[model samples]
Target: MAKTNYQELVFDITRLIPPGRVCSYGAIADYLALGSARMVGWALRNSFIHDGIPAHRVVNSKGELSGRAHFNPPSLMQQLLEAEGVKVENDRVVNFKEVFWHPEELGW
Candidate 1:
């Protein structure tokens, strides 16, 4: 896929993440057959400005808000997640497995 297309795919998948649920960068990368979690992070870093893409819903595999630094306020990502009822403590989701949304399970 073209670079722009790949980025778009990342954003699209991110948007599908339900409120209060999170998906890992590796999951999104694997869903698109990209084989690189960093690619998903790169796309999110560049496309986060797009209004429809809920970039905050994407987290690191360990359920940590590793991408928090990329947000404008940095803490915005945690705030957003908390607003949706996803508890975050010490920069990590409190009940990660309970709230994790897997792309493969969605059959997308």
Candidate 2:
């Protein structure tokens, strides 16, 4: 009978990611410990409703821009990342291991 604010929660974590870094859907899901990676993706897919969410900084576990299609022009996701100094090639983040950012960095 109650609605959870998982979407807001996802946004909170996503906002914590600094520029030039990225997190994985599964990583966020694991940090919240409330839903699966798919659920995290769902929240992000509908994130356009809110501004400043920085959803582009989130990628799949493999650093793939799996949610690119959700952007206005699918390439916008990669474009955003690149603008932040995070390189992406072939629909995936370049040097993923280096750009990967963990939510725990916030002491969560």
Best by lDDT: 2
Query: Across residues 1-108, which tens digit of lDDT does each residue of candidate 2 receive?
Result: 133699888988888889999999999999898899999999998888988899999999999999999999999999999999998999999899998999887784
**Clashing residue pairs, backbone N/CA/C < 3 A, model 1:** none
Superposed by TM-score, candidate 1 places the C-alpha of residue 107 at a distance from the truth, in angstroms, of 2.1
lDDT of each residue in 61-85, candidate 1, tens digit only? 9999999999989999999999999
As a TM-score, model 2 comes out at 0.94
The clash count for each model shown is: 0, 0
lDDT for predicted candidate 1 compared with the true structure: 0.90
How high is the lDDT of residue 108 in model 1? 40
Q: What lDDT does each candidate get?
A: 0.90, 0.91
